[model samples]
Target: MIKEITCISCPNGCEMSVEVVENKIIRVENNKCERGISFANEEIFNPQRMLCSTVKTSDPKNLRLPVRTDKVIPKNKIFEAMKCINNIVINKNIQMGEKIIENLLGLGVSIIASQSLKINSNNV
Candidate 1:
């Protein structure tokens, strides 16, 4: 079977055709660089993606805080990760890059604050 994919490892965004047989990559074609090969392999066998979303916050001024995984998590786990992220409520002001959840889903990736959020003084 031929699988078509666009490589995201670099700015080239090379569109490639990957031939797979029995779920194994047999060949990769039309890639601009070696990274495309790697991308194809990882995407075909064990795809991953960085998770970014918003979490609920106690401050009405900042009702939602942007958050993201420190590193890529399995693509298959995004919905599960979102479930865990959805259950979290940030009650205190958090700095950008601060850890929101440690070892999320035991995947060794922490969900971190993507932006600094402060409580509104009027709400205090």
Candidate 2:
């Protein structure tokens, strides 16, 4: 099976043509770097994607906080992962890189705060 993929490993965005046989990569073409080859192979077998989204926050002034997975998760699990993340409501100010959900969905990936969020004192 010949599959085409756009390499996201670098800015070049090399379009790749990968030949697979029984889940094994036989040939890779149109790749500029070695990383592209690896990216293409993974894309055919176990594709993954970084998750970035906002979670509800307790502070009214800051209704949502941006968060992201520390590592790439399986592409098929993105929706399930988002469901787990959406259940969280941070009650205190959070710092960037703080782990919001550890080992998210048992995928060995952590969902971390994308930016620092301070408390909103104006709320009575």
Which candidate has the top score in lDDT?
Answer: 1
Runs in model 2 lying further than 4 Å from the true structure:
none
Error of 1 at 64 (Å): 0.5
Against the unseen true structure, what C-alpha lDDT does each candidate score? 0.95, 0.91
What global local distance difference test value does model 2 have? 0.91
- lDDT of candidate 1? 0.95
Best by TM-score: 1
Candidate 2, TM-score vs. the true structure?
0.90
Error of 2 at 53 (Å): 0.7
Angstrom error at residue 59, model 2: 1.6
Which regions of candidate 1 fall more than 4 Å away from where they truly are? Answer: none
